[model samples]
Every structure is written in C-alpha cells, then in structure tokens.
Target: MAAAPQPLAPDPAADLALRLALTIRHDGQGGVADDLVDPDGLTRWVHAHAAALPAGELPFTADDAALAAVRDLRAAVRALFARAVPGEPSRADARHLMPVEEALRRLNAAAAAVPVVPHLTWPPGDGPAAGHRAAAAGAPAAAALTAALAHAAIAFLAGPDRTRLRACHAPRCVRYFLKDHPRQEWCSPSCGNRARVARHHDRHRPGAGT
Candidate 1:
C-alpha cells in the first residue's frame, strides 16, 4: 500500500485563504483528516490564524453553531479550490465534490452574510495596514468569522496568485498548495520523494521489459 501523506510543516508565508482550504488533508491511515472536527478545533484554528483576521474579530469562542457554520464554509472553500488547480482534484473527495456552481453560491452567500466596514491600523514601524471590521453590531461570531474567511478566499482566487495553485497528486496527499517556485511539483519534499519512488517502481516492476 502507498505511504499515507504527512502533515505539512508550518508555512507562515501561505495566504490565509489557502490555509483554510488546507484544514482538510490526508490522514496517516490513507484517509482524509479534518482539523475543524469540533468547536474546540474551530476555536483553535481561529486563534492560529489570528494574524490574518480582522482586529475586532479576536477573542472568539466557538460554539456548536459556529463550528457548523465554519465547517460548511470550509467545505465550500475546498470545493472551489479543487476546481482552481491545474490537474486532477485531491483524492480525498474527488468523487464527492460539490458542483462548482454550488460552491460558488455558498461562498458568495457566506461572504455577504456579515456586513463589514474598512479598518486601518499601523503597528509602529510595521506601517499602515488595512483590514475590515464587522459592521453588524449584533452579528454572531459565526457569521463574522465565516465572512472573513470567504472574503480572503475570494481575494486569493480572483488575484494573480491564483495561477500558483496546484493540487498535490503524490501518493495519498490531498492538499492544494501554492507553487512557490517554478519547478516545485509536490506539496513538500516528502511528497516529492514518494512520487519519485512510486514512479521508479512503476517503471522497474515485473513487466519483463516487454
């Protein structure tokens, strides 16, 4: 059997949108693994992504309802990501992807659910930065978080960097990654090695050179 895909190392340079799509990845058991499996998971993920989220959006505590909302948004994000890459979709849910049209609808709806206003902040020498603030004073935490993620995803997909998106087809990897370098193939060095090994075995196997 093929070696299962491994979890990737922390990459601070990855876009927030791409990071969210990566929450659903390959498990060691040759199956899919979801990071946002519960309210705690969702809360952890939100805090981990603090640098990219809006300022007032911090201090978040996810409940079951927020967990469900975020997971639904994540599903739409992954489905759209699967459609953005060059080759085949990730094997994790290739047969179960929502239609591109449906994914689009869900994403748009989530993004529009929470109204937002522009925010500008400057951290000393870090220079001025522009972000958003939730305009709906009564909006639930779930709505705010979901809209933030959806907007980030929209920006990534509609920007030039979209061309860098690629799906890792090595072994059991079910990841979508940005091709940081021109020659990069797999999602990581380990995946590249696995692909190379699989290729070598395919070429040298018992075909008797026929």
Candidate 2:
C-alpha cells in the first residue's frame, strides 16, 4: 500500500471557526459550489466576529457587546470542532446567546459524514513561517486548519497583523474572508449575482423599461 493514506488532522478550533464561517455564510451548501447559499442571520454573526479583530488588537473590548457575542460564538464553535468525533458530542452554554452552538452541533455530524481525509503535518511545530510554507503546498484541510490556528494564535499572543482578513463589498452581504483575492466582493457570487439580477429587473421593469 502507498503509505495507507494517513488519517486527516486539522486544528479543531480554527477549522471549526473557518468551517462555521463558510457554512453560516452560505447556508451549508453541502460543499456544492453551484448551490445557492444565503447569509441569513448567522452569517452576519460571522462577519461581526471576524471584524471585531482589528489591525493591532484582539478586538475584545469589555464595552463592546458585539465582541462578547463573538467570544460566545467562538467558544461554541470551538466546542463543536473539539468534540466532533463520535463517542462524545459537543455541547455549549449558548442558551443565553445565539443558537450558533446548536446549529453547529447539527452541522458537525454532517461534516463527519463527508469522508474527508484529514490533512497531514510534517516537521511539526517548527513555527508559522514553515507552517505557512506547508499550507501553501496544499497540506490538506486539517493541516490548513492547524496553520490557520497558528496564525490566529500568533496574532492573539504577539498582536494583530493585517494578513488575510477582508470585508465583503456586496450591498447586502456582510462577511469576512481570508483575503484569498485582493478584489473579492460580497462573500460569494450568490450575493453578487442576486444584486445584479435585482438591478437588471429593476431597470427593465414596466415604466422603467423606457
């Protein structure tokens, strides 16, 4: 056998956050690219959480309720990711907070069924510089998640840096991304397409058709 396909391994917390961000943003499209995804209310939560983290600070202000909600959501998301596997389901005290915790618990079961192979790690803990290099080499989802965690931890511990954070530009969509592209707009094409279609219809409708 060719190495027996090592099991997947991802940073449970970071992976969960990122996954939750993407999932909530697009309404868990079942990983289907063409599927129509909606932002809903939870999507807004992700955007707010990501935005709270600023350029040089952790974005956790004692006076900011938004930041507090983000903290709760983060904790709930962490629980879902950490207790993803069978035998011990994740639970959270989000009763006073958003239903994101419960939402993710349901979503986690779906994720585990996807048959995704965990990413591998090599030369582990050598630091983020090398971790990023490996991530660039397509280290798999788990590896990628771990690398993401490393970046977040660094920012949390050593101060923030504007590396991959971004805000969407779509009129109605408010979400954050890893800044994979410099000109990214809205969080997904669905938002862009919806805007475009609505505009097109408005322009060609009844009296305006002139």
Candidate 3:
C-alpha cells in the first residue's frame, strides 16, 4: 500500500480558506499534487479539522462524487484568490465565482433542516464560553462539509485579511500563505531557497542580458 499522505502543518494564524485552497500543490513543472484524490485522504482532512465542522457531523466517507466536487471547489477558490490578491483594482472572474456560489447554494439547501443558535456553556474544567452551534443532527455530512468550507471561503474573501493573502512565487512551489510579516514572501525556507537558486541560474544563463 502507498504511504499515507502526511497531514498539512497547522499554522495558528492561517485561516481555513488558505488551508482549503492549498490542498493542491503546483509542482512548478506544469503538474499538480492533489491530496484529496483518495477518499481516505479526504476523510482524514475532514477529521483533522474537526473543530470547524459541525458537531458530530463529520463527512468521514466522502464518495467519488464528493471528492470531485471538493477538488473543483478547491480549484475555483485558488483561482479566485490568484486574481483577487495582486491586482490594484481587484475583481473576481465569474468563472471562479460560479463554483463557490454553487457550493453555497448546496450548503444552504442542505442546511435548510438545521437551525443555528447561540449557546453558552462552562466546560467541566474550563472557563465559560459562548458560541453559535448548528443543530446538525440528521444533516447530510457531505452537505455540511461543503457548507462549512464555503462559509469559510466567503468570510476570507470578504473580510479584511483578504489583502494579506498570497500565493508562494517560489520555484516549484504552489502554496498559499498569509503574509504574517511585511517582508515574508515564500511559504517556507525551502521554497525561498528554490526561488533564489532559480533566480541565480537565470541571471547566469549563457549570454543572459546580452
């Protein structure tokens, strides 16, 4: 059997939207590495981020169709950010927005049966808390998953942090990361080294800039 795919490293400051869009890695050699290609991987992804999901409504058995839908949604989100982030006058392409809109529609349809309400509670050994909960019992798991992802995407795009979203321009790297620091560019040091090497190679190419 193939080795199980490694879980994505968690960044306390990264939002769900950034994480979701990065499910596919652009190999810089004109190919992509998709983590959601298998049902088991998809299931693990959902479980790993269980906190964002509705209580006990995890989509642990993602079918082929569900996997395809999520992949398409991921692509659309990536494309949307690619265009929206760097442009002086940012604009969303209709093509990219369609899938997101469709996802949201499905989420709304699926959530029709669930009621969202706010509640307060004090954990047995923790401080009191207040938060909203979706009464997701009996709700379709696939729909709940889609809705949760869609909602996160919407919030990320519409919120103030959208300006800080960026795609790593490093060689052979296709990951998205939040600009936590003003000078940060690549997603990681490895990517940064790759980018520097590529630049050095380009500058030293035979008869370059002649």
TM-score of each candidate structure, all chains considered together: 0.87, 0.30, 0.73
Cα miss at 118, model 1 (Å)? 2.0
Highest lDDT against the true fold, candidate: 1
lDDT of 2 by residue, 80-171 (tens): 32333223221222222335457354334333322222343455766432222231343333323223333443232222222433444344
User: What shift in Å separates residue 28 of candidate 2 from its native position after superposition?
Assistant: 8.0
Give the 10-residue window scoring lowest on summed lDDT in candidate 1.
5-14
Angstrom error at residue 98, model 2:
11
Give a tens-digit lDDT track for model 3, residues 68-129: 76666676676667755663211222223445456555434433434556668798999997
Better of 1 and 3 by lDDT: 1
Q: How far off is residue 107 in model 2, in Å?
A: 23
Q: Model 1 segments beyond 4 Å from truth?
A: 1-14, 123-126, 208-210
Q: Cα miss at 52, model 2 (Å)?
A: 22
Two-way TM-score contest, 2 vs 3, winner: 3
Give the poorly placed runs of model 2, Cα more than 4 Å off: 1-17, 28-71, 75-164, 169-174, 202-210
Worst 10 residues of 2 by lDDT: 30-39
Worst 10 residues of 3 by lDDT: 87-96
Candidate of highest TM-score: 1
Candidates ranked by lDDT, best first? 1, 3, 2
The CA lDDT at 132 in model 3 is 47
Error of 3 at 165 (Å): 0.6
